[model samples]
Target: MLLTERLMAGERVFSAWSSVPDSLNAEGLAATPFDAVCLDMQHGAHHEDSVMRCLGPIIASGKPGLVRVPVDRFDMAARALDFGAQAVIAPMVNSVADARAFAQSMKYPPVGKRSWGPHLAMGRSGFSGPQSAWLDEANRKTLAFAMIETREALDAVDEILAVAGIDGVFVGPSDFSIALTDGKAVDPSLESMMEAIAHISARAQAVGKHAGIYVVDPKLVQRYSAMGYRLFALGNEQNYMERGAAALLADAGALTS
Candidate 1:
C-alpha cells in the first residue's frame, strides 16, 4: 500500500531516514519492515545524482520512497516525485504560501502545476496501467508533508494544515526546539517547545490531517504517538551502524567468558 493509504487508514508509519546517501544502504533499509525509506536531501550527503541512484534500490525493495527535499525548492520536490518518490517532505515550510508551493509541485494539473514526466518513475514504480490511470491516481497517492520547524510555522500551523493537497505536517523537533529558544541546540526539556509540539499535532489532528515527527529513539515514538503523531522518521543508518557495531563488540568481549 502507498504511504498515503497507510496514513489515511490510520496506521502508524515507521520510516527510516537515510542520511548516508548510499544506494546499498537505502536498499537494505527499505527491505526492512519499515513502512517507508526517506532519503535525506536537505542536510544529508545526497545531491540530485545520488538521490536518483538511491531511488532505484529503494523502488526495487518495494517500500515507499520519500525525499526530504531542500527547503522550499518546489522544483527539487518535483524532481524527486518524477524520479519515483511516493512522497516529498519539504523542510522549513513556515507559512501557507510555503505549503501551497510544496503541494503544487507534487500534484498534477487541476489540482496543482506539476508537469507530466515520470520518465524513470513509471517503470521503477511498476505502474503497468494506462497513463490516464496513473495520472488519476498520482495526486491522491502522492503525499506532501510540510515540515513545521521554525517558530513562524508553529504559529501558522492552522493555516498550513488548512492548505488543500497538503497530506501532513512533519515536525522537525530538533529545529523546533532551537527555534523556540532562539539559536540553542534542540533541548526537548523546554516546556515551551513541548507545548508547541502538542499544539502542532493537535492542530493537524483537528483537521484530520496526519502529524509526523522525527525521533532518534524508539521510546520517544510511543510518547509522540500518544500525542497523535502517526508518522515517524527514525534515526538514520549511520547511527544504527554505530550502535550495531558497539553491540557486536560487546558480544565479542562477553564471548571470552
Candidate 2:
C-alpha cells in the first residue's frame, strides 16, 4: 500500500531511520516489521552512491525505502524518487517556498515539474501497463514530507502545511528544541518545547495533514503517539546496535568487568 494511503487510514508508521551507509545494515533493518526504512543523507553518512547501493536491499526486503536528502535539491529529490524511494523527506524546510519547491520536485507536471524518468521506480512500483497512467499513479502515491525544525518554520506552520502536494511534516525534535530555546540544551521534555511540538501537530491536523516526529526513546514514542503523532522515526542503526549490545553484555555480566 502507498505510505500516504496508510497514513491517511490512521495507521501508526514506525520507521527505521538509517545513518550507517551500508546496504547490509539497511537490508537487516528493512527485514524487520518497521513500516519504512529511511536513509538519512543530511546528517548521516549517505550520498547518492550509497543510497543507490542501499536501495536494492531495501527493495528486496519488501519494505518501503525513503530518502532524507541533503537539502532542497530538486534534481536529487527527483533522482531519489526515480531511484525507487517511496518518499522524500526534505530537511530544513523553514518556509512555504521551501515546502513548495520540495513538493514540486517530488511530483510531475501540473502538480510539479518533476521530469519524466522512472527507471527504477517503474519496475519497483509494479506498473508495467502504461507510462502516462503510471506517472499519475506515482504522483499520487509517492509521499513528500517537509522537516519542521527551525523557528521560522514553526511560525509559518500553517502556510507551509497549506502548500499543495505536501503530504505531511516531520518534526526534528533535537533541532526544534534548540530553535525553541535559542541554543540551549536539546530538551524535548521541557514544557514549552512539548507545547510547541504539540502545537505543530495540532496545526497540521487542522489542515488535514499528518504530523510526525523523530524520537529515539520509547517513552517519547508513547508520549508523542498520545499527542496524535502518526509517524515515528525510531532512531538509527547504530543506536539500535549499541542498545542491543549493551543489553546483551549487561545480561552476560560483562558490563561489571
Task: Assess each prediction's global lDDT (C-alpha) against the native.
Answer: 0.86, 0.85
lDDT, candidate 2, 90-137, per-residue tens: 889999999889988988878888888897877765667888788768
TM-score of each: 0.94, 0.95
Q: Mind giving the per-residue lDDT tens digits that candidate 1 earns over 58-150?
A: 888878889998876789999998899998999999999999988888899888999999868999987788899989988988889999999
Native-to-model Cα distance after best TM-score fit, residue 34 in candidate 2, in Å? 1.8
lDDT of 1 at 201: 90
Best by lDDT: 1
Tell me the spans in candidate 2 whose CA falls farther than 4 Å from its real position: none
Error in Å for residue 44 of model 2: 0.4
Q: How far is candidate 2 from the true structure (C-alpha RMSD, Å)?
A: 1.5
